[model samples]
Target: MSATVADEGTAPAGTRTEAVQALRVPVSRSYRFELVKLVSQWRIRLLMLVCWLVPGLFVAAVSLQSTLPTDTLFGRWMHASGWAGPLVVLGFAGSWALPLLTSVVAGDVFAAEDRLGTWRHLLVAVRSPRRIFAAKALAGLTVILAMVAGLVASSAVGGLLSVGDQPLVGLDGHPLASSDAAGHVLLAWLCVLAPTLALAGIGLLGSVVLGRSPIGLLLPALLAVAMQLAQMLPLPVALRLALPGYAFIAWNGLFAAPAQLGELLIAVAVSLAWAVAATVSAYLLFVRRDFTNATDDGLGRRALWVGLLPPVGLLALGFGAVAAAAPSTTGSGITQAKVERSVATSFAHLYRLQTEQLHRPAVTEAQLRTTATCDRSDGQVDPTGPGNDWRCVVTWHLPGAAAPGNAVYQLDVASDGRIEADGDGPKEVNGYFLVRSAHADAPNPLWQFDGDVELLPTSPKG
Candidate 1:
């Protein structure tokens, strides 16, 4: 990582500049230093322990469950296959758990020097804040990547040992042979890694801005919390489509027969974009700022405040603008047939999954026979492609039940073609719970099983 000093005596002014730059020391050296520090830190040591141990424990606990948990994307497969265990843990990891994992190191790296009042001493030894920031950020990212790897490996191993490597089912309920399932599960874990890096970048930005450990940690965690909350809010589908974390759903599509390649690309692009932007901004701030806390002039204080607020403020304004400008009911090019077909196909696929949990006689997709007519609203709106204002009167029959009357589904479709549907169907339209199978002992798998299915009609008919 060391750079050789340039010979300035026989060289031009540019060479002198190169020499000066070369004398600045390598960022890799800083990275190595940070890595050593991370390994030595007691809290980090504890975090590593938790990361490896928790997955094994979680998988073990899930193994004891008696019934399929049909709620999550891969919950039913939890006990059915070891592959499902990591996917399930991935769902939980995206929450507060992930932020804490990345932020703990990122948020503390830069800010710790300021908090400990060791900037003067550290700078004397460390050359520049640029090198320090690079090393710390690299170390944080490395730690997070390791944690992600550990969790995936441990969860998969734990599930295999405890649950047995049964045939893993895709999100669409298509059965994947045990051999092919391992690759898909690994890919799913890889897909989840994007947001982890993005969160780390955010943590770095927060740490540099706050100049303290706790606040640095808290800011990124709070942002993560806020994003999760925003995802749950009843907002315009188009606006939600722009959200950074919304890309997480794209991973669910990976478990499908034909993994949603378009969604996966978009998700990775958006998440990586966020990560890059945050990392660059953090690096710029860390490199340029006067961490000595000495104001060269009256404006230095003002400049600091301006620097800190503008990025955050602009981000906030951007999100607000999109939400405000978007229509409550965005237009779509979808037709009645398209809507009906997607709902019918997805419903039958999911409901059959539900019925399996309920221990009912097997039913075919043809048997469900979903009949529905969709209306875009009373305003003569054309439901051509995607819209949040569409409603469908769906009638489908199940075995051993009275001829049920019509059920209604109110649908909201995102610009990305993801659907958020609410309806008066028995249980929930999507992510509905099914009664556990008879003679199951431990926790039922299908209990309160809610699922996610992002719909972009596979076949559209006129």
Candidate 2:
């Protein structure tokens, strides 16, 4: 019953032929073979180790700091709650770390065989190019999943141990207890997997066509950086939503009260489509390559130079197509209506913060009954585009006030749905850059407030 390869080799000629035939039977076990090879690599082992260690080191560094990274979401609360640390790390990792890590193994998985001069022998052992490609892709995906797991586990444990479990402050300025914050963090991490898989597909395609480990590893990572840069510019909302990179920031929607789902839904759909298209393209190219002549010098210098053009050309073409389809007047998706909703909500929240500092009666966002009217460029143009010239008057009904009070805020709205608002205020209420508290002068929560609106229109909620 135990038929080893050695036993088959020692069998009679008829039995040896039968054993060979049996081995050729379509048994897809190449996944195991690829996994073994992948795990044995020093780089992969090191990557896993880094994933586990980096969070602890990062938490320790943050714990020793006096100031917070306020620019990053949840950064301002890192000292106030342990739960905030992981969210800050998640933001940083999505912007820079995750894309590069995804490229490392995915970009090299197939090309490494070409470098080792093992293609022919591998072909003989597997007997199916399709199986080999499938195996490699699956193994690469497995490694990505593993890396994400290690990071989430390490980050949560490190933050909890270093800072202790406390309530987290949401992007909407509401507090989330540790129990609910844990769920939101976990979901946010899960949302990251979609775009990350899309990046892996790009890396795999690079590995298949370029046959150079360095080029494969670097190209996807470079593209990710380029996307980040593009996000900062005034691009069309439809185009930005089509990009997989936007999904990284889309996770922030989960932490907002009355969670913004429009952008998140679009991001998941676009990212998955990219993953499927890239993977299929890579598979077709891999199966059709002439392995007999496939030396370590995969594409010649000229071909290698040519290989770089596709990714660039595809990016350009995609942008052009999306831009053409979007309306010139309403492309940015930042309308006066959406801005008014966001401004009113943000003012209500910051007003409560100011009230707390003054030791006045506590106010709830709902009880404030806040509303905003915004205009663009003094109403010279349509109040629907992103610009620094938007001005808003926010009115709120506070308890015991005979008439509603209003405050002016100058807003700089970005194409990416972020709004930077400065209170041009009655100093007694909105205060200046700093407000004196019992302890010391703290940054005025009312002076400058930041908020993000969903690109796609959704029903406004308090």
Candidate 3:
């Protein structure tokens, strides 16, 4: 039997086994062709341009500024993330621009075929609706990913160049160690891509349902705006779950101190689920729908409008509810003044203790006018009150043991009664001072001291 099988294998080339072996062929390399088509599209090129250029321009302008407040949370975040500022700027954009950018590509992908009446030609040439659907979907995903990459890279480079490599300080007013912050910034950038994919899927679904490039493009953008509006409502948790724009805000947790992974995971899962559903719906509809020509069916148009209007109406209702429920702030200024007064009173007591501790007998109350402005020989005068002069100014002279001149001691009090001092002689303590008010209605003692004081060159001279 073995010898007979061997003989059959070695049989003439025209035999069935030999013919079967020869029939096997390699799979067609259509994915590469699809990618080429995607890359060649003008819309894809425009996305790439915006991703790179917009970030670069914004970073360049910011970098040229003579000063940037290092104290602010956002400013510190920008400084630490380096070029990530422009990319972070995308969070602001994703609220609108990203949705529009995504829609531009997604909405046009399938709708363009219907508009140009090329659906029939593509279907016949491709010979597989499944492959055609996958190609278009992948092309849209590829464009989005490419734009994300460009935006991240450009923003990183631009920020690093424009803003120096500073350690990131977090929103909670704590510093992020350099290595830790860089990783977080990169991860945050990547996390944003998840929602972008979901946005793309929405646009693709719109394209499939609308069968017109204009509607497909505008639909996703409009939906994003609608979702944003809806998110403002005190809606049921389940209803909020249905909206996509919520994921963008959820991304901010990536920069949190403990790093909110649970919210991020939920966002990722929700976005992925939405993407899958939209892609599946688009695929099934594109494959089954009759697209013999560019002409729109009334039924298809009605479906598109019906699908679009519900979300829009919900959003409008949400906006109305929010507008009506917003708090009135007409009396806020008076409320703010009362709060400020409470703070001021609490700060006065601590200032009195600090001033009494620094006093010297050589620094006479008359020469050391706790109220007079001390004109340093260097031309710097210590102002005495909070209104740019000094909140509380205390001046005293230090008598020198061996020197011809007495050293000056000047303490300028801020409106908050925090004391700052600068002088010719060494002071034991320097920098900001804190004060607590002894009582609510009691006068601030530090406020009683004059701005100027003179110390005797010697105690005998005084």
Candidate 4:
């Protein structure tokens, strides 16, 4: 009787409960379980396989086509240099592929549980909503990272192997050695991580809020398309800068002579802002969600209304910030002097390349003493902001020539500071569409080339 009483006293209240909690699975195990679940899905396996193989296949297709896809940023150089392939693909992927890649898995992860009516079972087994959310998010992120890795790696290797390893031409027309180009390519890919994560965050929020697999999977891509369209519109420069979509192409600055960090920095900021807001909102909703009604239609109407706050807030916040900052940024828009300097600099470098390709005497950028004057075709009074109808006349002195030579180029300048110039000329000089190089006929780098100008406030001297 004494022993029995002593044992009963030692076994305090909730002793069995404590043991049960201890025996419950940790978050790490849950994360692994989520990963296994993802891998088992046929769609996820297909996505991974596509990511690994598409780049190489695309490279091969490019090689086979008689005409290059010059519409893309680096498309014209894809066959001539291996470094261009990955860049062209990057340009394409940023618009739609990246958003779809992120949303497919993330948007479906949570909603799939709801779709299959497994939420109750999962919660009972996991015992903590926080743990389940963390595990699912972590799993989705891991899959995203893997997909990104597979695409980048495959693209790099495919470009180098399929297109012979040749020197990459910088936006300034200066040649980049293979090693240096490799580094820039890697950094450019690294710069995209934050933007992709932001999209993933958006997808996660959609999954939790919509509680439907199809809608969740589609929300991110649809949002991406809408943002892209917004960017194409004639929005204010400050407003456009605030959108995370621009970050997709901001990596172009990395290839500039003096890497343009201003826009790239803005991109990082906006992307992180979106990512944090979306992710935090999703987390709050997921934890507070009522899973008692685990059926597909069980998510309450109130939660749906609350779930909309993040996106609406984000847009209002972005627009409000830009509107607030607009007054201070009025004078900082793109100017004629900036365009003149950029065109002069790019033309000088590209002219040198043309000369070398044609077996003419070599000339340096300094030796060219290039200068440019530009005006808008629309006869706009300002003629300073982004427009597609800009025209420029570039003049330069050649070695042993008494008089200076001039070339005319039509410029289409984008809101994001990218300038594409097409030369108009009498074929003898820098105007030929194609040039005969020592190896073979190649697209003339001087005929049509791209350049970038900084979007920051113009200095007094500029």
**In model 2, what are the clashing residue pairs, if there are any?**
none
lDDT of 2 by residue, 197-302 (tens): 8899888888887885587778679879988998887777767876777889898888778888767876876777677767877777777778878554355554
Worst-scoring 10-residue span by lDDT in model 3: 450-459
- How would you encode candidate 4's per-residue C-alpha lDDT over 190-255 as one tens digit per residue? 888878988999888889888874777798898889888876666666676677777897888888
Name the regions of candidate 4 deviating beyond 4 angstroms: 1-14, 295-301, 315-332, 378-381, 437-440
Instruction: Select the stronger candidate by lDDT from 1 and 2.
Output: 2
Name the regions of candidate 3 deviating beyond 4 angstroms.
Answer: 1-29, 66-87, 236-238, 293-462
TM-score-superior candidate, 3 or 4: 4
Ranking by lDDT: 4, 2, 1, 3
* lDDT tens readout by residue for model 1, 1-462: 133333465578898787667656678887887798888889988888888888878887877777655444576667668878887888788876787787787777776666667776767667787777777878888887787778888888888889888778665446688887888888877886787777777777777766653667686678788878876554544445445565566677776656767546655665676677778877776677765674221124443464456446545544455446544323332456656655555555655666666666888877777676677874388765556687766677876668853656677654434444565454444323334446552332222222233433244333
Worst lDDT window (10 residues) for model 2? Answer: 321-330
Candidate 1 lDDT trough over 10 residues, lowest sum: 443-452
Per-candidate Cα lDDT values, in order, are 0.65, 0.79, 0.53, 0.81
Q: At residue 2, what lDDT does model 3 achieve?
A: 60
lDDT of 3 by residue, 235-343 (tens): 4333443455556756555554445464456556666756666677677667776655446521275456554554455444433443343322111111212222222
